[model samples]
Target chain A: MTRFALTIEFDGGPFMGLQRQDHGPSVQQAVEDAALAITGEQVILHSAGRTDSGVHALAMRSHFDLEKLFDPFRLMEGLNAKLRPDPVAVTACEVVADDWHARFSCVGRRYRYLIRNRRAPLTLTRGREWLVTRPLDAKAMHRAAQHLVGHHDFTTFRSAHCQAADPVKSLDRLDVRREGEMVIVEADARSFLHHQVRSMVGTLAMVGLGRWREEQVAQALAARDRQQLGHNAPPDGLYFLAAIYPDD
Target chain B: MTRFALTIEFDGGPFMGLQRQDHGPSVQQAVEDAALAITGEQVILHSAGRTDSGVHALAMRSHFDLEKLFDPFRLMEGLNAKLRPDPVAVTACEVVADDWHARFSCVGRRYRYLIRNRRAPLTLTRGREWLVTRPLDAKAMHRAAQHLVGHHDFTTFRSAHCQAADPVKSLDRLDVRREGEMVIVEADARSFLHHQVRSMVGTLAMVGLGRWREEQVAQALAARDRQQLGHNAPPDGLYFLAAIYPDD
Candidate 1:
């Protein structure tokens, strides 16, 4: 048996999310079914993280083991062929030691949130970006974002349904910048609570729009209460950018 | 009557083109219908240039006369509201002189073509880019593109159905550059023959793929025959970037 690690890219508009559910389709089910069709063996695929509905991934990492022997390139091609008509693609695949894990062995994960700051409605990037018609003070938002860059109790940013054992997590970076009409928010961490990035971005948006002062973000984090959260940005603009492992 | 010049942006996936078509929907029809619905008067929508089917536009300049006086912002907002569900938006609007024509008065037109140079199938940007599996040398393509940048009779690149009186047109700029995995081709000209940009891009792609040498491009242009054309790229990757006017 060989363990394979796959880097995936998918449009999250069609599926329920990355994880399997009884309610609707998922990126996991699509990939697992594709693997089953190729190997004739049902395999459980594990991902680095679970994304909500309408959340996209640029290079999500995942892993699964197969008893059948096949070339890595051939396996990737076969799976992509079977995933046809669906917005999923296996961009990269490689063999790894059985001890390697897509989730537990990961060292870092990065996410990018896209916001289109404009008065006009989106045309080409309608579903891909969060549209904020009101003018945004991206510089002020960036200044406020610096307050949440280190380890802290992120309960205010954690979702009510999050299953993390503890409310504390080490956030390595949270940077915001404006690129043309897009206000990009990049977050990095060793691990994250469910909906943590979205929750933080939602609160920062309030600061950007002048609804809250820059220092208010620090106060929200200090409160350590979910009720103090400003809002949860929609899933349309969130993207799982990459995952880093020890081997890299 | 006031002639309002509007900067429009649209996703071309849903419309036949930017002009009124007999058999299918077009951006012109959508705007005209929206205007009629708002002002209770028939209006003709003229665009800077008529884009082919499935060609997107970032900021296409156009003009239409309205007998009823309406504030530019109100007209723009009302038109966008009525253009519901359509992938079209009026990004900017201003009143212009009666003689300012969308097509005739346009001094420069620019276009951009996107090509994804990768082995994997596209997911997030499926319809928005052209996928080329083979490796491309953007530098070589750019070098070969210089051969077409001056005054020339571009008969080989002209479409058979092109209505331009003379095949001689001076191309101001034709640049090819690679950004990460994307190969972008930007073209500029006072005016262009039908399918000129796509045809040029297709030929440049041949050069990039090493199918045709840089000199072969010169040879094809010197042939002055449409039969000598290498290929015509699809409209999927083409975008009307912007239209330049004299007063600006």
Candidate 2:
């Protein structure tokens, strides 16, 4: 048996998520089905991050073991050929050691949220970015984001359905900047509670819009209650940027 | 009556073209119908550029006259509301002098062509860029583009359906550059024959792919025969970037 590590990119608008579900299609299901058709074996695919619906990914890492031996390039080409019309592509594929893992061995993850701050409706960027008509103070939002940059209980920012054993996690970076009419928020952490990035971005948006003061974000984090969260940004603008592993 | 100039943007994927046609819907029809719904009067729209089907626009200048007085902002908002479900937007609007014409007064036009030069299939930019799997030499392409950047009889690049009275046109700028995985071709001119930009881009692509030498481009231009043209790129990657006027 051989384990292959794949770097995948997908426009998550059509899939339920990166994980498989009984309710609808998913990126995992699509790749797994393609693998089955290629090797005539049912295989389970594991990913570094599980995204929500409407969330995009630039380079998601995943791994699966196959009993049949095939060239790495052939496997990639075959899978891509079968995953057609699904808005998903395997950009890179390579053979990895047996001990390497996709999820458990990952050390960091990064996400970016895109907000189009404009009154005009989006034409080329529709369905790809969150459109916010009101002007945003990106500098203020950046200042407020500094309040949540250390180890703390993120209960206020986590989803109720999150299954992490603990609410405590260290945030490495949180940045907000304006690029013309777009406001971009970048977040990085060793790990995150479900909905943590979206929750943080949504609350920071309040600061950008002057609905919440800089200190108020710190207060909400101290509250340690999900109900205290100002907002939860939509999944449309969130993108899983990259996953960091020791081997890479 | 008031003459208002509008800066419009559209995806152009769903419409037939910028002009009104009996066979199918168009950007002109959409805006004209929106005006009718708002002011209860028939309105005709004149644009600086008449883009073909599948050609997008970043800011297309246009104008219309209306008997009903309207605040510029209100007119823009109402038209946007009525042009719903279509991939079009009125980005800017202002009252212009009665003599200001959308087409006749335009002094310059700029266009940009986007090509995704990579082996991987496009996920996020599908239908928005021309995907070429072959590796391209952008520096070589740029060197060849200089051959077509001057006064010339562009019969080889003009389409058979072109309505221009003369084939002679002054080309101001034609640049080719690579940005990451994408190659952008930008062209500027006082005016162009129909399909001229696409044809130039197509011929340049052959140079980029090492199929034609730099001098062959000059030879093709001197041939003044459409049959000698290398290729014509698809309209999917074309964009009417902007139109320039003297008063602006």
lDDT of 2 by residue, B8-42 (tens): 99998998999999999999999999999999989
Candidate 2 segments exceeding 4 Å error: none
lDDT of 1 by residue, A59-106 (tens): 999999999888999999999999998999999999999999999999
The share of true interface contacts that also appear in candidate 1 amounts to 0.75
What DockQ results for candidate 2?
0.78
Q: What TM-score fits each model?
A: 0.98, 0.98
**lDDT minimum window of 10 residues, candidate 2 chain B:** B118-127
User: By summed lDDT, which 10 consecutive residues of candidate 1 chain B come out lowest?
Assistant: B118-127
Model 1 accuracy (lDDT, Cα): 0.94
